[model samples]
Target: MTVKKGLKDAYSLKTPMDSVNLYRAWASTYDNDFAIKNDYRSPSEVVKYYSKYSKKTDTPILDVGAGTGLIGECLREQNSRKIDAIDISSEMLNLAKSKQVYSKFIEADLTKKLNIASSQYGAVLSSGTFTHGHVGPEVFDELVRILKPGGLFIVTIHTGVFHNQGFKQKLSQLGKCISPPVFHKVNAYGSKIDKKHGNDKVIITVFRKKMS
Candidate 1:
């Protein structure tokens, strides 16, 4: 929980409390130590795809597992839409708050129902949330529930668990509720510079809620 080991510590987290403890210790320096040092690319990549596929620009957006406001920061550079940040760690949320990039911040566990109403957001983008020991495909139901009809839901899922963790099957089962997922594969880190997790990849899954 007292994570000093960076990515390994993040990937080894098992319980929600484990995540809380890890981020609590890592939050202050997360931007420089974890994201910049590792050359993390998921946030930018996910946002890039969000801009590419999103049809609306004014509706509210929810940044899940927003962690230090990386996604919100990237989003702000592109638009002025109301973007809200949500994460499980208050410490991390505090760091995100300092960035002043989000309109609202919600601290909640993704494993349970968010206090938000259904079909509220025009688009929802999450980066570095669905991975080794963090969140899983089960949160997809709640995510979809909060998304408006025809809303875009874009997220990065660690490729290592895509098929084994039932994400593929779960997405398939959501047939009528969502459109078929469009997967964009990208390196989680700048492979050329970071040798440790250089080969690590995440599937940026893009889908929309059915208007019906």
Candidate 2:
């Protein structure tokens, strides 16, 4: 797919390849154009939940779909160290690396086996990653695999993905591996400057890996 030039066009992308192309094109101004412009709040909300439950600030935390490191930046504000980032777009990852917030970064698709070892992170945070045509419930097992036993993970999923894509069923299938999931409503559009920016529906799920 030819990369779209506008935020509206980016949202219309329907495939992972389309996502890759779009992010590559948007990397330079992603934060300003998308997160800030749309009043994106998933990163800060995910971090708020993660910090409340997580005791250590220096332990490794993986930021899936870390994008231009928006979540990493927010994580740092909470005094979090040892943050690692992974995104499918090298362009985005490179921009993230430039911020010096994440300890490391890897380019990989969420729907496949990651290059890192299992049980490597103390916690994981993701936002704006699971949505239309990006990734689906298939990534759950690998997410569980990478998190240490008892590791906490907070992620936001598009409301459509959560309801229409059998995310609840996938949670049921992994009952043996994770704690019961907790759902939090996320303002899909929380622009402080835009009074009418809260119509989109999304949910943030927080859960923990279980010890074998």
Candidate 3:
């Protein structure tokens, strides 16, 4: 298939190499393409939820799957300045950097060991990263590892992913790693994209790591 076709068909790719290439191809247009087309608002939504329990404003927040800094934009709008972003795509990071949202940008894949020190961030957030063909709950191990005790974690996990990807089991195994986790039903993958999609569906989840 032509490269253009590959970019268009990115959602179907399940392999690691394809995931990297797909983001590489779509990075430049991502903010306008998927972000605008689907009315992507999960970034702002994630930040908004975390605001309910805003912690240290001076420490860094680790934005996983920060793709184009949609969440960073929201965080910045709220006057958050210590946010740092990490993504697998250098191209996407470049776009995010131009927005001047994140204090620092790290290029790292969620499926691999992130080159970040442990218990460093005061909070962690992500959106549109745990969907089909992307990173999964296994990344949470690293997330839990790096987050300081009492750090907040807000993530938007696709409902299908929550059930099918052993997230439940992982959460059970990870008990007390964080306070009792709660799932919130915030809109995701807009209806304009699929009228048949569950209008009642949502993917927002929020939690706070317990003091160790």
- Best candidate, TM-score: 1
* Candidates sorted on lDDT, descending: 1, 2, 3
Q: Sort all candidates by TM-score, best to worst.
A: 1, 2, 3
Q: 1-212, model 1: which lDDT tens digit per residue?
A: 44465888888999989999988899988998778887889999998998899876426999999989999888889887789999999999999999898889999999998999999999999999999889999999998999999889999999988999999998998988999889999999984445668899999999999999
What is the alpha-carbon RMSD of candidate 1 to the true structure?
A: 1.8
How do the residues 58-143 of candidate 3 rate in per-residue lDDT, one tens digit apiece?
A: 25799998888999889877875588989888888999999987889888878888788899988889998887788888999999
Backbone clashes in model 3, listed as residue pairs: none
Write one digit per residue (lDDT tens) for candidate 2, span 94-182: 98988889888888888778888998998888888887767888898998898998888889988877878888899999999899999
Which residue pairs does candidate 1 place in steric collision? Answer: none
**Candidate 1, after superposition: displacement of residue 143 in Å?**
0.6
- In model 2, the worst 10-residue window by lDDT is 1-10
Model 3 residue 80 CA deviation (Å) reads: 2.3
List the pairs of residues colliding in candidate 2: none
Question: How far in Å is the alpha carbon of 33 misplaced in model 1?
Answer: 0.8
Error of 3 at 1 (Å): 13
- Which portions of model 3 show Cα errors greater than 4 Å? 1-8, 196-200
The candidate, 1 or 3, that scores higher on TM-score is 1
Residue 2 lDDT in candidate 3: 30
Q: Could you estimate the TM-score for every candidate?
A: 0.96, 0.91, 0.90
